[model samples]
Target: MGTWIIDAIATRHDRSGFSCGQPSLDEFLQTRVSQYQRRNLGQTFVAVPQGEDANNHRVIGYYTLAASAVAFQNLPLVRSRRLPKHPVPVVLLARLAVDRAHQRKGLGEGLLLDALQRTQAIATELGIYAVEVDAIDDSVAAFYTRYGFAPLLDQPRHLFLPIETIDRAIDAAS
Candidate 1:
């Protein structure tokens, strides 16, 4: 496998060739990421081959992070009991996808780790309680569950991993 450098997406990064076998995700990278960024809705990060030149880098995987809130009632009782009754702030992992050619090569895990690491750093200065994700299906939900995410009480496919858990994971990885 080749080395990859994950960073904020730029106009210089080439994304037209990315295909993750998920049409909506593929189309988002190709079309909507910039708009979301411009509107302050989210920021998309991309993983490209490490040695590629500035203008020649091809995005092989990507993830988007956005500021979001979740209703206190949606959280599981165990996680929400100590918090206030209002909505809780969170980092929304809006999208995560690896190119079809790059699937099964551990790139998906890499992207997820990168997102969590970024979330941890941001949480140090922000009021983020957790990182949440809306899995497209049960299989994807399972993937997040394996990494310690807990599903929302009312929506199983909407999962979250607390900042505390992310801290533990990062410390262990280090």
Candidate 2:
């Protein structure tokens, strides 16, 4: 939380020291982020460390978002009842990771809120049924649940929160 800004990944930032305690996540951020960006497969945002200190300017955390869908049949039985009998539209929070050095300082939560806020703004004209994510593990799943996401009836590790419901909550909070 020291002078830092969460923004799109840029060429000038260093990503060599980001280790979120998860090897896969760390590897992805270090190696594959640029390829994904180049292919238009996903849009990744970085939590860029800022301030007067030159050494602190690095990508400490990041998350990727992409257009995706969930098959109607894959939804929880109780939750799918009102949806169309087809693939439900969604925005996938494909990956989320915060550097281990930066953990417990609210960076993960901040990145998530940023992603959701961006999604909320885009939902204005897009037909997003919900925001979805395939949880990396149970711990990650629990973290998202705390933000109002619920597991898919069929896939316990998968979760989502309806756009309408999120909007309502945001309106209420404001």
- lDDT by residue (69-131, candidate 1, tens digit) is 989999999998899999999999999999988888889899999999999999999999999
lDDT of 2: 0.86
Model 2, 10-112: lDDT tens digits are 6766889888988999898889999999999999998886673555468888999999998898888777887779999999999999888888898898898
Pairs of residues at least 3 apart in sequence or in different chains that clash in candidate 1: none
Worst 10 residues of 1 by lDDT: 1-10
Off by over 4 Å in 1: none
Collision pairs in model 2: 76-153
The TM-score of predicted model 1 comes to: 0.97
TM-score of 2: 0.91
Off by over 4 Å in 2: 1-3, 52-56
